[model samples]
Target: MPDVEDLFVEFETAAATTFRPPGVADVQRRIRGRRRRRGLLAGLLAVALAGPASALAVAHRADRPEPRPTPSVSPSPTGRLAVRTVTLPGVSGELAELRFVSARAGWALFDTCAGADESAAGCRRTVARTVDGGVTWQRSALPAVPDGRVHLLPVDAGTLAVMTRVGYLVTMDGGNSFASHPFDAPQAAVRRVFATPSGLYLGCPPDGVPTTCDRQRVLRVSGGLHFHQPPVTLRSDAENALVEGADGRLWLTVGDDDGLTVVTSADQGATWQEMPSVPRAARQLVLAPDGRDVWLVRTEQPNGVWRLAGTGWQPGPALPDDTDGIAAPGAGLLVVTSAYGGLGFVTGGGYVEVSELRGPLRTSDPGTSVSVLPDGTVVAQHGRTWFLGVGRGVDRSWLQLS
Candidate 1:
C-alpha cells in the first residue's frame, strides 16, 4: 500500500517483454488471425440463423401426416391460390368435351336438358362455340344426334371435326355446315380415332376388310375425304393407341396376351419401323413434350406409367389414380386427376399439389377429361363445372368457368 504505483510497475515489468514496434510480417500475421476469427464468427452466425429452419424441418419430418384425400367442396385458404369464376353465356348442363384451337377460339360439347327431363335419354348432345375466350357461347345444332360417344378434334379456328360412332363430321366453316364421312371399315372395327394436321387416323380392321378379323390396321384419312391404310399393322384385336409426337413421328402401341409391340412412323405413316418390344401390355401411350420420351400406361398397373428412353422402358411416376390424364402445359408436366383426385402438377418425376379444386364445384366427378390448348391453357370439365388453368408457375390458378 505504501508504494502501490511502484509495485504495479514492478509487476508489469516482470510479466511484459521488451517493448518494440511490430514489423510488417507481424502485422500480416495479425491480419490473418483477424480474418480467421471473422470467418469463424461468420460460420457461427450462419449456424445460429439456420437453427430455426433446421428445427422446423426436423419437426415437420417427425410430425408429418399421411397424404390427405382429395378435398371436398370447401373454400381454399385465403391468398394461397387465387380462384376466379367465369360466366358461360347460352351454355348450360354438363360439358362433356372441351377443345380449344386457340386462346380465344374454342368449342364445348354439352348435353342440353333445359326445361326437359334430366335423364340421358331426354337430354340432347349439343355443341357450343366461344370466340371470345369463353366469355360468350353460341349454341350450334348438330346435323345428326350421335348414337354413342363423340369427340371434337379441332384442326383450325374455323375447321373442326367431330367423330361419332358411325363416322366423323367435318365443319370447315366454324360449325356453319358439317359434312359427314363414314368409316371405310365396319362400324364395329373402328375402335379409336386420332387427328393430325395431315388428316385423321383410325384404328380399324386390317386392309379395311376382315378375314381372320383378329388384327387391326392404322387407317389414315388425308384431307378428311379419303381413307388410306398406313404400312404399319397390329396383331391385337382388342385396342391400339396411335399418338403423334411433337416431331411429327407417330407412335403406335399394341397390347395382346403375349406382350406389347411398338411401332413408329416418321413419314406420316408412309413407312414404319418396329421398335424394341415392351414386355408390359401397355394400355395407352403418351408422348413427352420434347417428342422423344414415350410414356406407356401399363395394363398391369393402371396408375403406374413407364417411360421409354433410348432403348429401354423405365418406370416413371405413378399417378394418383388410373383416371388421371397427363398434359404438358408448356410450363411443366400436369396430371389431371380431376376424375379421382384433384389437379396435380408434375415436377421432378412426382406431383406438386396445386389445388384440390374442391370449392363447391363438380370438377372431381368421373368422366372428366383434361386437354391443353395450343396456347398452353389447361382445361377440364366435370359435370357443368369447367376449370381453366391460366398463368404459369406461382401465378397459375384453376379457375371455375360456370
Candidate 2:
C-alpha cells in the first residue's frame, strides 16, 4: 500500500504535467517587430566590430533599447465547459454522494436497498468510478458489508479517503484497491468526512445510538491515523455535507428539528463558530474554491430557493425557485442545477436558465452535484451518471446567463 506522502507527490506531479506550460511563441509574436529590429541591430553591431564602419553601426544599435520579452498570453481553457452524464446500469438505489478528483476521474455512491422489494434480493451498495470523464463507468468492488453507506473524500487527483458504515479505508492508487484501517469509533457509521489541509474530520454519533441523538460528535482524525481526544460536540445533528474552506477553516451544515446551522472551525475541530440563522432548512452546503464564498440550498421546500450565504454567514442573494444545486464556476458566477434537471446561471439581475442539456430528470433524484475543473469544465451528477456539460469560459462575463 502506498503511503499518503507518496500520494501527495503523485498528485503534485499529475497537476504539473496536466497543465501545459504557457506557449512562448505567442509571447514572441506579441513583440515580433521589436525582436526583429533588435536582431538586425545586433547583426549590424557584429559586422561593425569586424571593421571600423561596423563598430560605429554597432554603437548606434547598442544605444537602441532592448525589446522586452513578449508577455506570454496563454489563453485560459476555453469553450462551454462540457457536461456529460453516465448512468450506472446495475445500481439499485439513488446515489447519496458524488465527488470528483479531476475532470476525467470521479466516484459515486448509491444506496443498496433504496428501491429494493422486500421479497426480492436486497440491492448491494454500489461504488462506481470513471477514468475517462463520464463516458463509461465501472463498478468497483466494495468491502463486505450487509448494510453500509459509502463516503469518499478525494485527497488529491489519485488518492481518496473512503468511509463505510463498517470502518475507514484509504486508497492511494486511485480507486483500484482499498486498505481498511483498524481505527474504529463507537459509532462506526460515518455520515461525512471533511478532508482539510490539516487532517480528516468525521461526523458520527457519539455513543453509536441513533435515538441518543443529542450525543453527536465530530471525530478528528489527525496525522493520518492518530485519534484525537474529546470529539467536537455539536448542539444539533450535523448535515451530511462537510467542506473545508480555502481560508483553512472547516464548514458544514448542522441542523436538527429546528433549522439549519452553519458552523466554521479555524483550528481544525479544536474550536467552532456557528452562524446566527440560515433562515431555511439546508439540503446542501458548498464552499467556493476561494473558501470564503458559500452557497446553501433548501431541499425540503418545493420552491427550490437557495440562499447565497458565506463568510460571516451574511446572506448574498436569494436564488430563483426550482434551483436544486448551486456551484461556483470561478469568479462570482453561480451555476445552479434546476429541479427539472436543467442547468442555469444566477446573476445579480436574476436567475438566467440555461438550456436543459440532459433530460426531464426525476425530482426524487438526489440533488445534482456540481464541480468546476481547473480547465473550466462543468461536471455534474444526477444519481448514477455523471455529466460533463458545456463550459462557459473562465471569466465572469462568459459565465453570464445568455
Candidate 3:
C-alpha cells in the first residue's frame, strides 16, 4: 500500500494550488451582498480579532431576511417587558431588521430561502409595514427587490424612504400609496438609504468589479427621489455607515474594510469635511446619545473604548471585553452588555443591568447582534428569537408595544 503520509501531502498540494482566499476588497463586496444572513463566518471572524468595535462598523456594510422567530413570553419580573410574537404576512424567512419611529409606526425587512429552502449562495427579500407598532405587519408594496435586501428610513410620522433594486420608493401618507422613481442610469443599483432631519440620501456604488466600477457616490433626494447635483466623495463600492445629527448635518463613516474614516457633510453630500479626530485605522463608529462620537480603536487586542468629549478623546465607558454592540436606548442612556450575557443601560451615573436571563441571549451569542431602534428601543437576538426593551429596573415601565 502507498504510504499514508505521502498521499496526504499530495492532496494538500493539490488543494493549495487550486484554491485562494479573497483579498480585502473582495470580502467587502461579498459582505454587502450577504449582509442578511445574520452572521457569516467571515464577518464573525472579523469581529473576533479585528478590534473592539470593528464588528459593529463592518456589520453595517450590508443587511437580513427571515420570518419572525417567536420567543417564550414569560413575564419578566426584573423588567416590565412581556415577550410577544410578531407575525409578518407571507413571511417565508426570518426578520432581518425592525424599527419603530414612534410607539405607533414602524417597518420590518425579511430575508428568506431563495427557492423554498435556504441557500448558501443568497436569499429572497421582503418588507412589511405596521401602524400600530410591531404586533402585526402587512406586506408593503415595493419594487421587486432582487435580493430582498433594503434600507428603510422613516422621514416623519407620515413619510418614509425605501431603497431597493426597483429604485427609490417613498410613501408620503404613511405606507399607503408608495411612489417609485428610477435612478439615473449610472446610479441605479441601490446600496443604502439614510433619512436625516435635513433630507434623505441614497448611496449608489458604481457597478462592475474593482477593475471597472471602482467609484462610489451618493445621491441626495428630496420633494421626491430626484437626483441632486454633485455627489459625495466616497469612492468605493463598500457600503458606508451614516448617522444624522441634531444640527441637520450628516456624519458618514467609510472604510477599506481594513480601516475606516468619519466625515461630515453640512450641505448634504454636495460637500464634505473630514473629521480628523477619529482614528484613521479605527473601523467602529457610534453616535452617542449626546450626539458625540464614540469609537473603538485599532489595537492588537481590543481593550480600550473611547468617546470624543470636547478637545480630546477620553475613555467612554466600561463594558465587558466581549461587548459586541452599543446604542442610545432612551432615558439619556446607552444599552451595554450586562453580566452573564444579559444587557444594561448606561445612564448619566451608572449602568442599569438586565440580570437573570432565563434563556439564551442572541446578542451575546456568536453571529447574532443587538441594535437600538430610532426611538431608543434595544432589540437583541440569540438566533431567530428577539427581545425588545420594556421597562428598566430603575425608573422604567413595561412598554405598550401593542
The reply for model 1, stretches above 4 Å from the true place, is: 1-97, 114-126, 141-153, 162-169, 180-193, 203-214, 223-236, 257-259, 277-282, 299-303, 317-323, 328-340, 356-364, 391-395
lDDT of 1 by residue, 319-362 (tens): 55433344545333544444444555554445555544644334
| Per-model TM-score on C-alpha atoms | 0.60, 0.52, 0.58
- lDDT per residue, candidate 2, 253-274, as tens digits? 4434454566666776566676
Evaluate model 1: give its lDDT: 0.45
lDDT for model 3: 0.42
What are the lDDT figures for the candidates, one per model? 0.45, 0.42, 0.42
Candidate 1: which pairs clash? none
Q: Order the numbered candidates by lDDT, best leading.
A: 1, 3, 2
Model 2, residue 240: what's the lDDT? 25
